[model samples]
Target: MKKTYKIKVDCAACANKMEEACKKTEGVKDCNINFMMLKMKIEFEDGVDKDEVMKEVLKNCKKVENDCEIYI
Candidate 1:
């Protein structure tokens, strides 16, 4: 499945970091961070625990850019 969420990335560089971070995260098949739209698109892997996976993704995102918000 696919999901999109609001994000708070500071700039393009941070967006790139976020993309890398999301791709590294387990349970994510694909990801795209749209800085202009302040949104994130996540394509989930089958059998993935949605909430838990997102929580980890959120945690990973915060590591790169503290203010980026991923609306659950």
Candidate 2:
């Protein structure tokens, strides 16, 4: 399944970095961060746990932008 999440990203670099962070997450299959919308679309691989994946998303996103929100 795919979900769109609201991300509090500052600029293009941060957005790109956030996308990379999400993609590197273990449970995630794909990720796209749109700077204009400040939203991140995530697709999970089959059998991946959504809650577990989101935890990874939140953790990695913090590395890109501290205190940023990622609404799933």
Candidate 3:
């Protein structure tokens, strides 16, 4: 499944980092962050709980970009 959420990121580079972080997270098959739109699109793995997975995605994104925010 795929979903899009509002995101807060300071710059394009940080958005790239967030995208990479999200892609590396478990339960995520793919990810994209658009700095211009301040949004994140996530493609989740089959049968995974999106809410729980997004929690981890947000946590992982924070590791690389501490000030970034993803609205659950």
Candidate 4:
């Protein structure tokens, strides 16, 4: 499944980091962050609990960009 969420990121580079972090997270098939739109798009693996996956995505994003926010 796919979903889009609001996001807060300071810069395009940080948004890229967040996207990479989210893509590396378990249960996430892919991820993209639009810095100008302040949005994040995520594709989840089949049967994965999206809420749980998003929680991990947020955690991973924070590791690379501490001030970034993903409103799931």
Indicate which candidate wins on lDDT: 3
* Ten contiguous residues minimizing lDDT sum, candidate 4: 63-72
User: What's the best-to-worst order under lDDT?
Assistant: 3, 1, 4, 2
Model 2 poorest 10 in a row by lDDT: 63-72
Instruction: Encode model 1's per-residue lDDT on 1-72: one tens digit a residue.
Output: 999998877899999999999999999999998889988999999999989999999999999989888887
User: lDDT scores for all predictions?
Assistant: 0.91, 0.88, 0.93, 0.90
Model 2, 1-72: lDDT tens per residue?
Answer: 998888787789988988999899998999998899888899999998898889988999898889778876
Off by over 4 Å in 4: none
Best by TM-score: 3
Off by over 4 Å in 3: none
Error of 1 at 66 (Å): 1.6
For model 4, how many clashes? 0
- Model 3, C-alpha of 27: deviation from truth (Å): 0.2
lDDT of 4 at 14: 88
Clashing residue pairs in candidate 4 are none
Assess the local accuracy of residue 31 in candidate 1 as a C-alpha lDDT between 0 and 100: 97
